[model samples]
Target chain A: MAEFKKADSMLEWFDQRLGVVNFVKVMMTEYWIPKNINFLWAMGVLLTVLFTFLVVSGIFLLMYYKPDVNMAFDSVNYTIMQEVAYGWLFRHIHAVGASVVFLVIYIHMFTGIYYGSYKKGREMIWVSGMLLFMLFSAEGFSGYMLPWGQMSYWAAYVITEIFGGIPVIGDELVVWIRGNFYVSDSTLTRFFMLHVLLIPLAIIGAIVFHFYALRFPHVNNEEGEFFDFDEEAKKYLAGNKKESKVVPFWPVFLSKDFFVLGFFMLFFFYLVFFHYNFAMDPVNFDKADGLKTPAHIYPEWYFLWSYEVLRGFFFEIAGVSGKDLGLMAFGFANAIFLVLPWLDRSPMVKPANQRPYFKYWFWFLMADLIVLTVYGKLPPTGANAWVGFASSMTFLALFIALPFITKAEAKKVGGK
Target chain B: MKEFKILAVIAALVGITYYGIEPYAHHIMHPEVAPADFSFKTLKNVDTTLAGNAENGKVLVEANCIACHAIDKAGYPAIMPNADAAASYGVVPPDLSSSGRIYDKNYLANFIFDPVSAMHLEGKYTPESGKQFPMPAYNWMSPQEIMDIVAYLQSVTPKVTEGKETNKATFEAACGRCHDMKYAGIQATTPKDNLKAYMGATPPDLSQYIKSRGEHYLHSFVNDPQVLLHGTSMPRVGLTEKAQEEVIAYMEEIGDSKKAERESLGIWVMLYTFVFAILAYLWKRKIWSEVH
Candidate 1:
């Protein structure tokens, strides 16, 4: 047998009761990862590191955070940032982590799609990861309300008001979610609970699910080549290391992860200290005023693309109201991501690099999302409105065109 | 190199979004106000070339200012207490100790000549039926005497810290009479209704004005409120160039208290992270070499 770690008596005693050594073998030492995967694969682990940063910093912020409408703004702005020692550091870490985590997530999501990691039997991995993202987004929206600032209050108000657009029980559902006619103390307190306790627990569960799902299908290689892991792992254990296409997950894989993580920390903390203001909206510095609405309101940049999709249907088409059409389109945009594995019908294993049309589609989709995000921030007036309409249409059109393009590619390859 | 290409794209996108687009969007949304004038050029001129002796200025301050304004650092208390003064004039006349440094010298000289026109409160502070301002125009006083009073005020003032504290005191001197900074525990010296009676409405509580209005907006608005919000009751406070900077610094401090700490710690954290990343790269190379 190939020895992973030489065990002593103390380890042996624990190993007998807990199956500690075997557990490590199954999870890490014996778990084989393809060697060809590049640093793009490391985005998943970077997200985990960022999540840990958020949780640790969030716990510190929780110590001083007061959820009451009267006290919430001051508690965050004064009690934590000014009064408590080193509190600013923790707040910075949490605030910056919230925004920076999204960058890694988009990278991970795109990397999966790019290499067709979401294809074959790996759909569960992508789905579970997407679940975590939705949960994280929920967490962000809820946590934003706890600050009780002008933007936080107004953003919560605008977002919850969207639920009232649902067909039948829409207005009642809005009342149920907010627990009032408008966003009030009940809404704030409930969101505080979700942000802190409930959603975080869901995220943790989703993280475990995501990781476990990846175990069966294995991490997809850069070129989407699937060789037998057992044979290559045996070769690695027998010391014909260069010939093996797999590496032990513990020492070999984790070392590389740590290197990526170290570089990520360089980027993350640079933002935490030097450029934290980007994460903190200046309008939110003022206390929440219920009577007066801010002149201009835009969601944070991460949500801007999706938000623009919701706003893009500017004209009435057929019988539907523009808002209802926009709302339906927005819903379509969000739900489309979940079905990506099924939508792509390519016989070609890797989606990019080899496939010419898919490569162009990927870049076009990326450029479209960026355009949507930019237009989302600008006022929807004159030509800016038309640009948003076209971009959002393109976002949907790309996905609708995906199956046709991939089917043609499959026929060209002369495969199922 | 591919990673660097990704990094460059990310940097470019963020740079475009934050530096380019955000400002451009703001400009489109908010009407562009004229830039602030610290020199008091908007006001009618007061020739500051007229030199005055400190000894002469001290006598003028005693005669003209001490009736309602206190020179506490100079051992002159107001003859009327603050409550009585507030009862008489809609707002209590501010103490004159720091006026030499905080208020523009030209503004001080001209304000003494005509209090009504100097503050741009011509309609409100005029000699109307029981609505006249308490501090009457000292237009009868000569220009030299007004400069002397300013010099005397400068002499008697306690030393204010150059940047932060001076700026804070300047904010208090210029803005505290009409505005409330609840975040900083500063309530307006003039009561809300009193200010409403005097200026048509109570000005906003300015606790987070630095954040809501932003630096550029605040600079222009504070220098001349009429420029941005035409017909605004808020008068141009006529602060000196240094005093204007001090006022902005004070607002920034209240709004972003951790700015100094964040800035100071940034370089060290960056250095540590860079070194750690370098070590990790070295370790990664070493570990990969064994596999090869």
Candidate 2:
């Protein structure tokens, strides 16, 4: 009877530790994420954090911000000068952080493209990412005018004027977007709403779908193979195939991600604490005087290439004068980037495994980017000026040629 | 499996919510969030005529002048890089309190019309014995308007005394802590970045700031100046446009006095490139981590 009582106490002790045992069992059995995921895998996690930062900061800015031209400039200055402590810091970090985010996103997308991450059933993942990119691009362009500085006003003026080149209803479309004869208070307000509210809400919804689709299959690599399970062992024991090498979702991968996040935080903090000065250009500080023209009024750095591309096609291609044609070409170039995923139809998953024609086209695209950037920096004069103009046309040709070239390369390599 | 699915959902929700708070806190700290309401309507009401119209412009002259120019001596207050009489008289405001004794209506109008032409258009000052320096012209106004100003100046009798000089000294002594080394009444055209690059700590001159900027911008600036101009270490000076136009006229009356130091664009380009390259490298590193 004493021995029986001892056994009962042992059972109680075992019961006390059931929660820990069950947790381990569930993790071992159900979770199939790979243990060998490399740094490339970190991008997915980093992107999640980045998207969150943009949304949260953007919403707060929208709270006090006015979209009207009369109020927009003052509103931004007010936000910086008198709003709240660290409000300026938040804005600067978010503004600069956005540029950083895109810089990271573009590289991540390219890396995914090069490594064959979108193959077979993984097409949805790429498509979702593309949708997210388009949403982000729209969001960036729309929010740019929120500051309502001379740059924002003129940039919107220059960019929106591009729709006038689209033939037939182009003029009407431009007017519709402007909400008046010009890009006025109404247009700014609408853009503010779209940027701060609509686009972000859509992006968040799409992110969930993107992650859901991403979960169905682990990422593919250059080899293009899947884990195979033994048929006999599966027939009696279980039907599931050899899945991803099992591991805990925390501590291992999470620790490495934390390290990368720490590094970025350090850089971001340094910029905020030491260099907290606003990007209000001297020309912008003069109160959007329509009469006085600033000697130079370039777009923010991120949009320089597109601006240069538009300027390239200004006179020669469309016979249009002034900044109109340049603006059109900029719009067209970016539109092509939005639709890139559907354009490339090479059967091989990896960039390295692509046909020679596709490979050559890719390098040409890279060269076009370099040319556009160089052209953006030059003064609009002399032989070098014309060369800058020519660079945009070259980039336009390369952009248009990409779809046809990829199709041809696929035909030569494999019909699919 | 169902319980584990529930757990994952809960975990993701909590993680995302916590992460979202970081940037939310970051955006609340901007400096320009609130602005004082400044109206153009209110500024038009301040009557600039000194001492209720009976003093006949003498009070206006006394209230405004006596800061820098002296009547007896040909010039006043000689400083380095501007030690000569030409520098003092040509650049500084002229003593118009005794104008009744020398010049006529036509002379004053012509002086107002083309002050540079009236004084031979020589620059801020001339070292030559009889060459004499010219004042900047106010071409925006008509001849009749210039005559009215001349008549107003001639009507005033000079009230030279110990008390007036002491009052002027007190005003300057108080304001001089900030305004002593101002741009000799000229409008500042220096870019903020270029200004920082050149003069290590000298504040910009606003001597002719009003005439150049005009009514609309000047009104906006005076309402809450720093909002329009970022990081203005200078405090606001209390003056209505009507009250300060003569001072503005006087500053323009002595134009082209100083030349700003120029900056090298090459150095700017180098700095921009270095920053761009560093940003690109960091982004590439982020991408590389995702690739492997």
Give the DockQ (C-alpha) for candidate 1.
0.54
Candidate 2: tens digits of C-alpha lDDT, residues A261-371: 554555544544443222333334334544445545565545666777867654544466646676667667777755556666666555444556766766566556655
Candidate 1 — what's its lDDT? 0.82
Cand. 2 TM to true fold: 0.55
Alpha-carbon lDDT, every model:
0.82, 0.52
Off by over 4 Å in 1: A1-8, B1-33, B52-68, B73-76, B79-84, B112-165, B196-217, B228-232, B252-255
The per-candidate count of clashes, in order, stands at 1, 33
DockQ value for model 2:
0.03
Model 1 Cα lDDT, one tens digit per residue, A1-416: 54546556888867866899999999999899998877887888798889998999999999999998889988988898888998989988988899888877887888787888887888899899889889988988898788898889898888888888899999999999998899999898999999999999999999999999988889888789978888999999999878899988888888899898898898888888877666888888878889878877887778889999999998899989888988899889888999998888986678487786688888898889888887888889999999999999999999999999988887887773
Candidate 2 chain B has its poorest 10 consecutive residues by lDDT at B254-263
Task: Find the 10 residues in a row with the least total lDDT in model 1 chain A.
Answer: A1-10
How much is the lDDT of residue A37 in candidate 2? 45
Best by lDDT: 1
